[model samples]
Target: MQFDFSARQLITRLIFWLSVSSFVGYLIGHVWAAMTLVSVSLLIWHYLHLNKLVTWLWNSKSLSPPMAEGGWGRIYDGLYHLIRKHRNKQKALNERIRRFRDGAEALPDAALVLSNDLTILWGNKKAQNLIGIQWPGDVGQRIDNLIRFPEFAKYLEAGNFESPCNVPSPLDAEKQLELRMMAYGSDQVLFLARDISKVHRLEEMRRDFVANVSHELKTPLTVVRGYVEMIQLAENDFSPQWLKAFSTIEGQVSRMDRLVEQLLVLSKVEVNSDVENSDIVNMPEMLGQLIEDSQWLNVDKKHEITFDIAPDIAMLGSDTELKSACSNLLSNAIGYTPENGKIHVSWQYDGERAKFSVTDNGPGIKAVDVARLTERFYRVDKSRSRDTGGSGLGLAIVKHVVSHHHGELVIKSDWGKGSEFSIYFPNEVISSLKN
Candidate 1:
């Protein structure tokens, strides 16, 4: 394509110029008839060659370009080079696509390629078996129509791929699958599915074990506390040392009982993830009750407690779970804050979102420890947590409840200042429950 056409053009142009000059010379010498005949013949020959070159370029159907002679050969050579380069580029592109398809096919997870409209464009072998869509027969069929499920369809329509959705397997009865989708190109989607039945089953087993153990331990713990109290009542018969031992026994027993109760609540929350959302919680009523409980707990410390509740900000969620989560935050704040500190409980809607937050004038948590505060048995000051009778599972239970309600638990604090903890519910869940 880069070959210089100027040489060919220059020579042809020079010949034409020479003919015109010769014709003028002859005309001046009074040989006008001879010059006219020579000019006409040259003009006719040039037009014929030009027409032939145009026809070859526009209509020729050959593997190679037309075999041209003279100046036309250069033009033909440039066209041939361009055509070969284009063919090479096409071949390379096709090879890369083939390789990509091969790699995708080798993946263990099922994969689906969909068009802009969610039509089945292509699918791998795993998809054929798991998704139950035949390759050629199902091609161009709507994916939503083929694999219909309310949750899966809503996930597709939502256009938010930040999370994956779990759905029952279309193939096996005892199997479950996690489906994740990603968008590429111009509106095309790629969906992948992985079997998660084993993982799900293991989690269920663990929750069941914890719930059973917690439930069983409650009775013995109550009996132990009862006997310890009975011995304290007969303190006059024993020494002061015996009375002190009874007090320690009673406190440790109560602490252990609280831990067991928290564990049971956490297990129940985890197991009841699929519970129906039929409980409508009255916000002010719940908060007022929590405030009363906090007041009694703070009697010794005499901390300032305040409430900024939106009376009408009620929600449809598990009342038991919500109360537990909210109470844990309040109790944590009360326990951690020093005497004369302030604790504020607020519930309000900020334009598009609603939140219930607890602000405490306590020693702020460390930056590195804040992230893991929600983990079970995690404490910044283990001795202080023990003194406060905290089982260290309160935040863990709060985290589980928040996630179960499709909400987020946010923690914000600065060193030596106070900390604010909030539960921000998902807009979709709130809107749906309101309707």
Candidate 2:
């Protein structure tokens, strides 16, 4: 059995051996020689144990402690226990890592770990199946080099991950993939790619259905409206109640016509994913014409309309789409604001960006409603919206237009106070400027 060899016990044992050796030497008249022999023997014993310990540390595969007595045995036992604990902990840690890797591999979406510099550090099999990222070979390559789409490259370079980038698959043109990036560990990014071909196809089908239905309804609506107008021309022959009924019918027909027209416009914008940026748009001229039209529409409301348009502000965009977007905003302000309310419109280009804003002192929208303002058919007050003849497609059209031009639509409003609708165009779209 090995006893714990404390320093005190070892010292006591040495003292006893020395005393016994000295006693023998004194009897034989060789005390110094006996003591030297004892010391040398003790030194040799310690040297042998020290060599055994060094060998165990360097090359021993077994956890069993080397046999010894007293202090050396105790030291061996201590080392064996320490190494065993460390090995067990390491084994548990490795098991956890294996489980995590297995879970990641089983995910349906393609997942990749990337360094800050966008180097592909690791990816699962789905990455290969979805985006053609081969394992082992592509691990050290930069992700941008593998996915060469201009939109995808620009999105990665911009470092903005708030919105996912939707692009056609590089491997197959018919397939669609939505790519998202998120911050992972320090200075690392987690990239995810999902197959969204079905979702994309469904969206396209919906747009096509809306466009076709709107086209079909147009002829019938025109015929009905023409007949209603013809009947109104003979109001003198009808009774008072009949005349009033005919008037209501005409108003409803007009509202329906407006709704169908707006739907066609929205579908057209949605179908065209990219805009033609070749045509230069004169912001000052376009907004000036819209303000005039707005004043004419506001004759009944008598809202104090004002505009501050900067001259010669130009950008590359579709003139027709820009006019539709600007017209909607101005007309919305005139329609929604209370009578005698103040409306202000401004167009400004400060070299970096150009902005068009319409501010109105009307019944401002609530905080919750502001977020859903751009949703088609969403209205803060449904009954009031009907009275104002709002088809609820105006803001939706404006949003799509701004997105198509790679711009932002910002709406700021406070309940019971006022609201401002602003569209900002990035400097890249600005084609010319004059002070």
Candidate 3:
């Protein structure tokens, strides 16, 4: 057993008592010696009491808590409390992690957390449904082992994270998917996948429709042009009545020509609108050309036309396309307006946008028909449109051109108050004024 008191303390107490006993023995005669012995014994007893108190204070295990109710019962109590708090904190952290996992798993798109070595660490329910994964069984499986596409495997190995890549679905042979990879945390990656089969199908259908229409129109147009040339060459051989018949044929031929032209313009706009070679069209010059073209058309009906142009209001787009769009709008305005009716072509430039409006005093479009006006071959007054040499595709072409250039085409009309067609081009197409 170890003594709590130091050797120096014990020795100091012993020396003090020895000096007291010797002084007492010298002061009294024979009785002094007996009193000195008793005093020495009492000093020894007091020293023992002090030693016991020091030992009790220093030796922690020997003493209990003052109340045993409030203070810690033992040193182990601190350790037990620390352990319990740690367990509670760990349980809370685990619950939070579980909540996060549950939320991630419920997402619609397939999600997979993968390691740098391409092993899948975790996957959501959607991922299992899409990629045929079986819970914990598929956890440690390599991505290549699960997804057996050379293109996807190559993409993963390349490690280029600039943009997402598309891959064929392993679950369905006919379906396609878009796969995107993101660096999530240290040594971990996330793969997100979405189904794009419907989008691909729609795109394919659009291309086919355009191609079919172009081919069908091209054949008819070629035949009509050929017959017109034959009729022109054989004019002398035909009667006066044949000449009138030729005039009718010529009108129809002209309509066909206009149809072909519009079709070509629409096709070109669709293909090249998003490309860089498209030029910045000067709106004033284009509108000037449109005005001149409208006057030529107006000569047949003797309609009154006016222009309210803002100087140097330019837009970035194909010159041909804008001219075609403007000409179509102007022609429609002129066609619907009665003789001597006023038609206004106005242009204005706000700080952020440029707008062109073609207003006419004519039998305006009804509200119910305005929504369908931009559809191909949709005409409010088909007989009037056909008689006025309209191809029923002018508004469709205008809508397509406006949409391609990221512009807005709005039509405001009342039953009899006339119609106003406004086109707004964003500032991205028309930046700053040039002096």
Question: Which candidate's lDDT is highest?
Answer: 2
Q: Give the better candidate number (1 or 3) by lDDT.
A: 1
Model 2 stretches with alpha carbons more than 4 Å out: 1-40, 134-137, 433-435
**Rank by TM-score (best first):** 2, 1, 3
lDDT of each residue in 1-435, candidate 2, tens digit only: 335557799789899989988999999999999988998999999999999999999888777879998778788988888899899999999999899779989998999999998999998899999999977779889999888898898898787899999988879989999999999989989999999999999999998998899899999988988988898899888999988988898899899889999999999888776898888888888888888767778889999988888887898999988999999998898999999999999998755889999999998999989999999888889999999999889999999999989999999998889999999999888876565
Q: Given candidate 2, what's the lDDT at residue 149?
A: 92
For candidate 1, the per-residue lDDT at 151 reads 77
Per-residue CA lDDT of candidate 3, range 352-396, in tens? 888889998888999999999988778888899888877778888
- List the pairs of residues colliding in candidate 1: none
| TM per candidate | 0.81, 0.90, 0.55
TM accuracy, model 2: 0.90
Off by over 4 Å in 3: 1-209, 212-223, 229-236, 273-278
Quick one: ranking by lDDT, best first? 2, 1, 3
The candidate, 1 or 3, that scores higher on TM-score is 1
